[model samples]
Target: MSETTAEKIPVTVLTGYLGAGKTTLLNRILSENHGKKYAVIVNEFGEIGIDNDLIIGADEEVFEMNNGCICCTVRGDLVRILDGLMKRKGKFDAIIVETTGLADPAPVAQTFFVDEDVQNNARLDAVVTVADAKWLSDRLKDAPEAKNQIAFADVIVLNKTDLVTPPELAEVEGRIRAINPYAKLHRTQRCQVALSDVLERGAFDLDRILELEPEFLAADEHDHDHEHCHDENCTHEHHHHDHDHHHDHDHGHGHGMKHYHDEDMQSLSLHSDKPLDPNKFMPWLQQLVATEGQKILRSKGILAFSGDDDRYVFQGVHMMLEGDHQRAWKEGEPRQSRLVFIGRELPEQTIRDGFERCIAA
Candidate 1:
């Protein structure tokens, strides 16, 4: 990557279900004096009603197909809007895209990966989802978009905790973890959180995973006491612990133990000690994504390819995948491969078997 592309503008996608405090979070982001200029792209102008120097209203005309997929239609409009933003180069340091309450984040996210121009000018920093603490459990059951928003999040702000008790907050958090174990969760009232927690997160950057979540590949941390309370009047029977994974990043945040289970949307993590045959792995991965794109919301991997000195890093949103040879393996560092997939009803065994077959002899 050239220095020009290396310094590509970071784009943050903000999404949530209806009445989930998205606008409140947007206002907070805009109002914060972080000494950075942001070019905001919002679904509707009047809805947010916020004054900013570089705010653009999106038409939100992208329609979903019969299968309820929105990526096909929104790609063109997003490309056009993003291209226009590139013209005003020095006006902003980063971009924030706020989707509608009912929007499916797949198409919005796919835009950053699928388009050549957009890819050159921008990189997806993270998908920050603001979810209503009191209503999220119900929304998860009644609204598919709600599930998608939570599943796609790199940072989830469970807002409006004042509306619910501590036990209820724990329940909502549990539901969220069941869907996406990888996302960093924050409990807040009125969408209030430290600005450092959400911006420049490097969520989509494959190399930054170690920096973001140091325990991502650690095996001992895998045994989390997963539990959840589905009933409204339920007691706090779930096991909770304070587990802090320190990062070199400035934001000092600790993650709590998370546990929950949802049949529709879930996350799968895979690891391999052996180097993989790229030729075999690539073809198998392509076929898997092609056949199960809709079910596969987000896929990321850092692989030890056979006969390669550099680490092979790849990530995908839906069917679109992008990868490259990242930094070289350090001397004596373990060269195991790690992969995590967050989506709906993934065929875990089939994927594991295919990945195992890709192991080099």
Candidate 2:
């Protein structure tokens, strides 16, 4: 019999570019009596403080005790805060993590899977990305975070739709579709979508996930090893970045306060020691392309091709994906499949699962 793991509770991560209406949507979710309790987490009270009046004035029940909604100064504080929330398991039915406009989401997600304390308590539900329809395309032209936010989302919300003309809306939607094909897109104005529509959508599932990826099944057959999977107190912190620090570092284009303005191309590398099936994995890839393709500066990876000794190499632009053989697993060489995603703070897990769906259970 194959070894199976226990199911973990899900928490949603909400992200978007600066002034993209994330707080408005969050306020709406907090007010909705959707029959589920939500514990809100964010960078700081002051960051989203501007929208407090709107959030508090909304009809939903408001609870702002001294430290209930998890907020932190540094990115590293997320794990400890999430651990605190898990202790009160019955107090809230779910958790909602809101990232600052300047924030990157990769490190936030790494906390869930990499940290023992966090992984033991909470599971990632889904990544919901909000976009300012009126200004997103212009922002992505020079902002890497904007693209990353879109590429990583399981659900994409095109907020401020009313501000854009029909042609502008169509152009932005087309751009979003090219970058991420798998994420569900929500069109709204002033974050006016139903809270139930975004939060209660039931986007993540473990059992159903097995049915989605075939590559994992085969990869599971082989003994795999990874440096980050150990039980020791995880100290490695995944930093959410807005630019490709590789060649652009010397140019000093995306550092400090300017980080939010860096429009350079970015990429992320995803690796798994496990083999995966192609059938289940295709949806995530398609979703990525359809939702955030235009913002995608670049993407490429080696996937385990089913029934063939050769590995598959997939490359794509905004909504366009092309793949062919890269190389075959060599004797004594690592057979692990790895994919590098270079776009703005694209959620690694969503992209990880895109290929993860290919894993055969």
lDDT scores in order: 0.77, 0.57
Model 1 is weakest, by summed lDDT over 10 consecutive residues, at: 234-243
Model 2: how far residue 242 lies from native, Å: 29
Please give, for residues 310-354, the per-residue lDDT of candidate 2 as tens digits.
766665434445566656656776455655454654665566556
Q: lDDT score of model 1?
A: 0.77
lDDT of 1 by residue, 164-200 (tens): 9766776787688778766777778999888888889
TM-score of 1: 0.84
Weakest ten-residue segment in model 2 by summed lDDT: 218-227
Show model 2 residue runs off by greater than 4 Å: 1-7, 46-75, 200-206, 210-361
Residue 214 miss distance in model 2 (angstroms): 16
